[model samples]
Target: MIKNFHQYYVYILSNKPNGTLYIGITNDIQRRILEHKQGLIDGFTKKYGLDVLVYLEMYHNVNDAISREKQLKKWKRLWKIELIEKENPKWSDLSIEWND
Candidate 1:
């Protein structure tokens, strides 16, 4: 049986490829990304215009997602770039197709 199957997301936003990155964890990735795009959310993302969803990962637990978010936050820029490219080579805005 799948116990505590709640899912969470750890996502990365960027201004552009190889640009400023923001790592965050959210239970609703699509909504959160939309908020970032509309500048509804304050702080680093809004201030830096980090609206592009370049990378994302899902976890079964909030703690796992939060842990990954914190780990990615401390990663060197190059490492983060590599990680993003691994999934999104073009660094495309994954949220674009979300219709927000």
Candidate 2:
């Protein structure tokens, strides 16, 4: 028998351009982003308002996503910023239209 699994994502959120950045991995990217946007989950995201989904990289395996997130977390701030700019030069909230 075979089972289907949803893709995982390493996502980055920010308060503003050149502002605070938060990196995380999730299986349900949209739901996680919504939670961050609504301040549903407490801690860094809520306190810093790091609610703008600036970047995302999808992975077929959760292990890959977890590994990427960990690597991003250890990167120098400038490198992470560069990664975000590569796809999202404007640092737009990529999750704002998840419902659409």
Candidate 3:
């Protein structure tokens, strides 16, 4: 349960538990997560049904978040799985859906 407000985050969204990962960086984590959840943005994410918030890392600076996002993107799938498992063992979606 994340309660802190932060500026930037390196987040991973998935189509399902441990399925089809999409890595991204965002300043407004909640809003961006919501957007993906609702399929509001049309692209690879929307196409792949990448809505589950499997992993996230908050950062105070955009540069750090972007760098982390890039590094994660370059990593092999196994490495990404290890990184996610280190924090989110069950691979659960963290987004608290605010939609009515």
Best by TM-score: 2
Per residue, candidate 3 scores C-alpha lDDT tens digits across 1-100 of 9867658989998887668889998888888998988889999999999988989899987788888999999999999988888888988778854453
Task: Give the higher-TM-score candidate: 1 or 2.
Answer: 2
| CA RMSD (A), model 1 | 1.7
In angstroms, how far off is 28's CA in candidate 1?
A: 0.5
Ranking by lDDT: 2, 1, 3
RMSD after Cα superposition, model 3: 4.9
TM value for model 1: 0.91
Against the true structure, what is every candidate's RMSD? 1.7, 1.2, 4.9
Write the residue-wise lDDT of candidate 1 on 1-100 in tens digits.
Answer: 8566587999999998888999988998888888999999989999999999999899987888888888888989899999999999999999888764
Query: What is the per-residue lDDT of model 2 for residues 21-56, given as tens digits with 9 covering 90 to 100?
Result: 999898889889888888999999999999999999
* Model 1 spans > 4 angstroms off: 1-4
The estimated TM-scores of all candidates read 0.91, 0.93, 0.86
**Sort by TM-score, top down from the best:** 2, 1, 3
